[model samples]
Target: MNVALYSTPRFGALKHTIQSEEQRNSSSGDDVAQPPSSPSNNSSHQHEDAQDLLSFGTHCDVKDCRQLDFLPFRCDSCTQTFCLDHRTYESHKCSAAPNQDIRIPECPKCQQKIQRPRGSDAAAQIQKHIASGCRDLVLLAPRRKCNHKGCKNTEALSFKCNRCEHQFCIKHMRVQDHTCSSQSIPPSGSDAHRLAKPGQSALKRAITAY
Candidate 1:
């Protein structure tokens, strides 16, 4: 009877060990950790970032302007990159090149702005502008009439005397015809011009002086 009791206890301990092993296996299967990523994949991601950095260019070479850029202005002479504002040789002060040749022809008639064709003559373009009536080429003549009373002749307006407010033709531009006031008349020893009667034409006095 004692040997039978010992056999029963040994069997119970063996069964308990098997059940504990099953429970541990089930818990491990429920929470299995994933394997670590490969080094090749990490390297590929790093390579992609490097490629993106290589695609974009560096900053502008202009003074005090260090902005990142791509497709920048590349000078043919100096082969140096520059911003749009400093693309020219003069703007950047390039040592490899001088000033560029770009001249816009202007109209000689009225000095109007015009767009000129490549390899075209500037003089011909000016003539074309004048013919198109874009500018006046003819010398305009004056249409002002004579200031003398009862005179019906037109002449170029030239006189700006203070005594006579009106413009006069060449024939009537004299002070006698317009009856210039004493204040407007310059200092002269001639009594005919200084002592002329008021409201009366100075023509009679002028004729006597002449």
Candidate 2:
């Protein structure tokens, strides 16, 4: 009778062990199924983030010019990434009257009249004019021109005079000789200047001057 009792206890233990093993397997399978769902959720979140990055009418940081476009372009002036349309619009229009759709025969930034592109539609020609003027402004953005007697060579235009829409190279800007009607020079200096210096002092000076 003792042996039979021992055998029955052993059988009960075996049955319990088997039941526990099955439970463990079931729980493991559920856990395995959950992992796939998490990946799908993560993928959906990533896709949404990507979409948000590409929405239309987003302004490109390029040049701080208000050109808006789908693709971001490196501004030749500011070297910041900006949408194309915003750059065109900002370069062409006065900052104070940005909404005013005056046909910019000249580059608002540089005050230079841009030549019309041949065989281009009116809108296209206008865009070209704006781009050309923006280029000139960017090129001259590094130094201040000596507003002083006959010193046409700008002093490395370190500062932009928002009131005058002119870039002062360095010397003339220090004297505060230049005046701008609009305070629209990006508070930041040109991209070329930043890359050339990359010094905190240089960047600080540019910001303070702007």
Candidate 3:
């Protein structure tokens, strides 16, 4: 009976020690299996969120075309934001297009076209064009006037005095009829040409009709 009691106590102590060992192993296994949250992954997620906020799309201001555009265009005339299709003044039917668009001023002297920018003086551009020696200006002033001192006559065709190299109308074409210099000066290189050109009358008639 004494040996049995000693052996039974030893067996109970051994069983308690085995149970404690199993409980510790199970708890350690659970700790090792679970993964810890990573700071770098959390930071990457936050960066993506910030980028989405920064790259937000803009809505087109046009009432009929309010499409969201990642890269919207702004109208210079109306000063309103719009999509690619409605960015131009004509496309949007802007009322202020005339004021902000480029201006083409017609030359008063030569009837030529010149481009003038928005909000700039068109007269200044025309003056610049004249200052640059407009080609049409020379063609427009093809008519020759009488060089007689007191006569204010200009004709579609004028006769040049071969003796004094002066231009005159048919009435004073003779050297004595108008006060010719009488010096028998050589005809000027400019006035040495024909008295009546073919297109002079037609050009003068067109100008008069206009």
Using lDDT as the measure, the top candidate is 3
Per-residue lDDT, model 3, residue 94, is 74
What candidate 2 gets wrong by more than 4 Å, as runs, is 8-35, 38-40, 56-210
Q: State each model's C-alpha RMSD to the native.
A: 16.5, 26.0, 18.0
TM-score of each model, in listed order: 0.34, 0.22, 0.36
lDDT of 2 at 137: 24
Ranking by lDDT: 3, 1, 2
Which stretches of model 1 miss by more than 4 angstroms?
1-11, 23-32, 35-51, 105-210
List runs of model 3 lying over 4 Å from the truth: 1-9, 28-55, 104-210
| Candidate 2 least-lDDT 10 residues | 92-101
**Tens-digit lDDT track of model 2 for 1-210:** 877976797888988999999999999888877444678888999999988876755564545465556666554434555554544435433233333343435555456554443222234555565666455322232344554455577454256554674556555563234443454533335555766675877889999999
lDDT string, candidate 1, 77-106, tens digits: 788888766666666777777344447666
Candidate 2 vs. true structure, TM-score? 0.22
Alpha-carbon RMSD, candidate 1: 16.5
